[model samples]
Target chain A: MAITGVLRPGHAQIRVLDLEEGVKFYRDVLGLVDMGRDSQGRHYFKAWDERDHHSVLIRQADKTGIDLFGFKVDSEATLEKFEKDLQAYGVTTKRIPAGEMMNTGERVQFTLNNGHAIELYADKKDVGNGLGYHNPKPWGPDAERGIAPTRLDHALLAGGDLDQALDIFVNVLGFYLVEEVVAPDGMKIAVWLSCSNKTHDIAFLRHAEDGKLHHVSFWLETWEKVLRAADIMSMNDVPVDIGPTRHGITRGATIYAWDRSGNRFETFSGGYPAYPDHAVITWPVEHLPEGLDYAQRKLHETFLTVFS
Target chain B: METQKGNTTSVMTEEAYEYVKITIAETGESFDCSTNESVLEGMRRLGKRGIPVGCRSGGCSVCKCQVVKGEYHQHRPMSTEYISKQELEENCVLTCCIKPKDNLEVKVIGKMHKNVCEK
Candidate 1:
């Protein structure tokens, strides 16, 4: 009950080059439950265990990157309150009418200092994870499918002026800093923030450009599943950026790969649960190689530069 | 017209297409690229890490390179943010989007450049 405003990561809208190719990869390879296409031709999907109608949306475009990332709020009142609060803090918010994104309620949209569009919404039609209310089953057929993840976990975004964006997420959105990576100059180059017990609900990396996407991560159950994800990626010839290794930062077991459109996604598991009372864990830039890849003890150049 | 001449599979049966030699200016590696095939596709088929795999389209800009000495045709538009007017004029293009028009030499300048050159 303590976790109120900005409950969890609700959805991320991505832009892909080919709609059908994206559908094949996300639905068949990644194992997300396809929620069908909208009137605007944007396809929607959700993790098998997620109760919400959809958490990932993709549309065909000339470019490849994320369009927006949204979070769910506790109630309609909380949504309105946050809008006013954000406005008071000199941030503008726009109300996108309900049904604009099918099953999703009206969204209060705003852009961060780093040029990423963020949304806050209070309502989404819960379709029940294929398990009825009373005496529901543990899992269904979808859970056993290709690289099936439990839920959309978090996203690491790349952009400049990350400190300003971090302040907005912490001070205004009711999130607390869970971990940070500091540069030689003592400025935080990367930050992980949390709204719930999860290690990070969303993270940011300082970069030269604005609105760059590092990766959108999905939560798997165990280390075995992370390895299975790698197998599936190899089977499908999906290009992997890094991992099937451990991150020294969150201690999460992960594998980073690209979708057909070049947008990066992660299949991850095993990060220490973070709470509001816990002190922020800091990683020095000097220790970043160990901080990024604990097993290899090497920092990858692609991890720093190649972002969509 | 699919003839297997050793390891190379020639699919240029119906059309009179020729393979152009492409040299990696950074690593001194060279590969045979078909005139109809994109430079990235050719290098990728080499089964080596000459250039990083990006979108295989023009969008990601991860496969960007400078045409140090080459004639290529850009089939798709590169992002203006990455390839500015001056950069484009300097023959900077995404390798995934350009097909070799003749024998060429290119410098790896993409974000993953170090992965190839340093190695």
Candidate 2:
């Protein structure tokens, strides 16, 4: 009963350098279940345990970055209500047909001031997680297939107008500011927002580049699992961006790595739960390194400068 | 004829090979593997399809295993972040980086699977 509007982050359409290689990487290395390709030639995948049809969509292109990110709303009424809310707030919105995405109903899409594409959808057919509701085994074969993350968790995006972006999410979408890093002059440099409870569902940073994707994170089950993910990265030669470390902001144990296309992804575990009534935590700009990597307490130049 | 550890495995170092016997503790499946490739590589060569795979290069730990009664070498450095020095001392090894240095009985000991809210 607590979550009534935005249920969770639903899907992200990402561009890759090569579709077949991306498919193999996502299917065999990352362990996402390939749901097959559409006439549009885009590949779709769902985490083994996700009930939704797909959470990641990749298409081959000259560049690599996110095209759009979507959230699942509770119902069609909520979808309509949000559309009206966005229009009332002076944001332009468009309706995409139900079948635009496989098994998905309809989506109301819009672009934030920072230029990141965002969407809200009411329905997607759920494909049970291979384990039936009654008398289910812990996992099936796909669970052991690759890096096998459970679902797409959250994404950190880079943009110039972080304040306007934060306002849109908090004021328009009913999200809460979970954490933020503020410059000494009192302007926020980065902000984490949550629609439901498990820490940040999406985050934004101040970057000169508009609509840059910092990383799309996947949740590992434990600190140990995050470590194992790091090992997998070494074995496969995935370029490790950072971690097998802990983040002071969310208390998440993490490892950031890149796919072949140069897109960043994270395997992390642990984040303290926050409620709407909880006070937001603020970190001074100088203390950002501690917030980004608690153990090292060093601001990684690459982390601050690089986004794909 | 068998090759022993502490000596040249073969005439060519790059292609040198060592023989190993692996036991899949979960399915009670056993097979002979080689040091020229990882236990994971051996599993695939033998059509053994149970152990998980990721980053086949050693960056992700989908193929973590444990040595029950023999010695092995990590061809690469494993992150202590995931497998602590203590766990490595306890005989856990990433199969992707694992190379048999002795006739060994290894167990697939990693406990990982898909989880809700885990992505």
How would the docking of model 1 be graded? incorrect
The A-chain TM-scores of all the candidates are: 0.99, 0.98
DockQ of all models, two decimals each: 0.17, 0.02
Whole-model lDDT, model 2: 0.78
Task: Provide the lDDT at B9 for model 2.
Answer: 20
- lDDT score for residue A60 of model 2: 78
TM-score of each: 0.87, 0.73
> What Cα-based lDDT does every candidate model obtain?
0.85, 0.78
- Candidate 2 chain A has its poorest 10 consecutive residues by lDDT at A232-241
Q: Give me the runs in candidate 1 sitting further than 4 Å from their true place.
A: B1-20, B32-59, B66-92, B97-104, B111-119
Measured by TM-score, the strongest candidate is: 1
Q: Model 2, residue A280: what's the lDDT?
A: 93
Best by DockQ: 1
Residues A1-308 of candidate 2 have per-residue lDDT tens digits of 99978989999898776677678777877788999998898899998889899999998765567899999999999999999999999999999999989999999999987879999999999888889889999999987777888889999989899988898899888999999999989999999999988899999999887888888988777887787777766555465668889999888999887675656788878998879899999998999899999999998755775556
iRMSD of all candidate structures: 8.4, 14.3
